[model samples]
Target chain A: MATFMDVHRGMTGITDEQLREAHAADLAIQDEEGVSFEHAWADPDSGVVYCLSEAPSPDAVQRVHERAGHPASEIHPVPLAV
Target chain B: MATFMDVHRGMTGITDEQLREAHAADLAIQDEEGVSFEHAWADPDSGVVYCLSEAPSPDAVQRVHERAGHPASEIHPVPLAV
Candidate 1:
């Protein structure tokens, strides 16, 4: 089993290019920490981003995010009924 | 092993009481159709609701929503990395 973190973004202050850069930095941080980001999506209007990831625990997710300099807004446990 | 659908809601046209009623009705519709609603959450500000359900097919999810008289705004397939 793994824990996932849903990271929200404040897109109003950041440009699209900046967001991509941040995502790249975060991806590297997560990859180094052995966290697999299953999927991530952004709402253009809301500027919120939801990330689905597989990590040993929620703390690991936070560690990677902290290293990336963008901590998550909320983390939710994803337990699949399947 | 199963397909999951994320159902979105619109809160502007409805009240809290109305939303609860709709949820109850949707829950019943989904339950009768063999879809297990594993979890659900709502955002008070946006009036958007997200429902996670384990269903055999995406069409099954739509069927329940249609029966409940509130088809989802968007349904995304959830695949757990765990």
Candidate 2:
């Protein structure tokens, strides 16, 4: 399994409720894109949201963000500490 | 591919260098267990280290921690915002 953490910066204005709303809809998005969204979190002060997911390719991860209308700032490859 | 975020607490006294040292050793440990680690971060104040990784089972993830001398506090599947 390929595991990764994608973090986004400059989310200062977004609220957890708003993001959570987005997350509620995100399931369908993931289902449609063939990706599994495991969890998502945002720092209230820092305006950063971290997302973890499973996908065959990184492009699929990006596609989900694009469709959601919130462009990600840093979609880094988070190597798990196994 | 399945992504997960494992957060461990009670590390209040550990330093970044100390954790980084462990992380450096983690690669070889991962290779032996057939797990791939994407990244790890430690909170100096909170003593919490969050790790992201790819593995076939949750037990595999725990095995790495046991061998490393630090057990994980929480292992949650991170749903991707696809």
Candidate 3:
């Protein structure tokens, strides 16, 4: 599976706890799309949330997020990790 | 400790292997500054890298990255989590 980093912008004022809940919610439904969410991070001040996941394609990742009610503004493949 | 997400810009063309090496190198030296790097993600096409870490302050995180020779363009605190 390829790794992906999806970004959600304009989320200013969103708290970390809210992100955690959203992430969990996404994970709960992700299996339907073959996406596995690994981690999530957010910058409350900038309103940018990032999610790391492994999936067949970016679309799968996006579909998961979309279903979770927080669709990403951009999704990019992460070809490296450590 | 608080979590942080640091962004590195203008890293276009950097491969996954190179990032892995850099992340490992950072981990090797991070303890000196009291920073614990948890994970790293890079978008090769966008020349952007995101690192998740736990540290006393953003400065400590910046110091570690600077020492690793990959200074961050921005750093933000993450105050909430699941």
Candidate 4:
């Protein structure tokens, strides 16, 4: 498995409830794409959300997010982590 | 405390050993500034390294990285996490 950090933009003023819902949506169907959405961080002021996940590939990560209705603007592969 | 994702660029071809040493340096002095260096992700292909930390402010995160001899190029505050 590989780690990924995906960024979503244009989510200004996102509330905690909304973030939770979105994360839950990803978790619900993550297994379909062999992805695990671990945690998410959001800066509502900047309208940017970062999601960390472990998946077979970046495509799998994107599939999970896209299906969850929050397509990422950028998906970065974190090949090395510590 | 707030979470931060700091970016360091222009570190292409960094080895795993080098990354560990750098992370260790930050861990050694993080307590002085009331910060905790959590985890780091690196994409040597893009020459970008991302460091996740809990800090009082972005300045504190940068100070630790700067002291570790690898100043961050960009630091984003992640005020909300789940």
**How would you encode candidate 1's per-residue C-alpha lDDT over B1-82 as one tens digit per residue?**
3645464656544455666676778788777778776655555444555666778777778788789887778765544212
Q: Which candidate is the best by TM-score?
A: 4
**Model 1, which residues run further than 4 Å from truth?**
A1-3, A13-16, B1-82
DockQ of each: 0.08, 0.09, 0.55, 0.72
Candidates ranked by lDDT, best first?
4, 3, 2, 1
- Name the runs in model 2 displaced over 4 angstroms: A1-82
Q: Against the true structure, what is each candidate's TM-score?
A: 0.49, 0.52, 0.86, 0.92
Looking at model 2 chain B, report the run of 10 residues with the lowest lDDT sum: B73-82
Which is better, 2 or 4, measured by DockQ? Answer: 4
lDDT of model 3 at residue A40? 77
Q: List model 3 lDDT by residue over A1-82, tens digit each.
A: 8999888889899975688789888989999999999877777888878778899999999888888898899998878676
Worst 10 residues of 4 chain B by lDDT: B41-50
Two-way DockQ contest, 3 vs 4, winner? 4
In order, the first chain's TM-score in every candidate is 0.75, 0.82, 0.93, 0.96
TM-score of model 2 (CA atoms): 0.52
lDDT of 3 at B27: 93
* lDDT (10s digit) by residue, model 1, range A1-82: 4746464656434445656666677788777778877655554444556666788787787788778787888766543212
* lDDT tens digits by residue: candidate 3, B1-82: 8899888889998897899888988898999988999988888988888889999999999988888888999898866554
lDDT of 2 by residue, A49-77 (tens): 77777776667777887788665665544
TM-score of chain B of each: 0.74, 0.86, 0.95, 0.95
Which number leads on DockQ? 4
- Angstrom error of the Cα, residue A82, model 4: value is 1.3
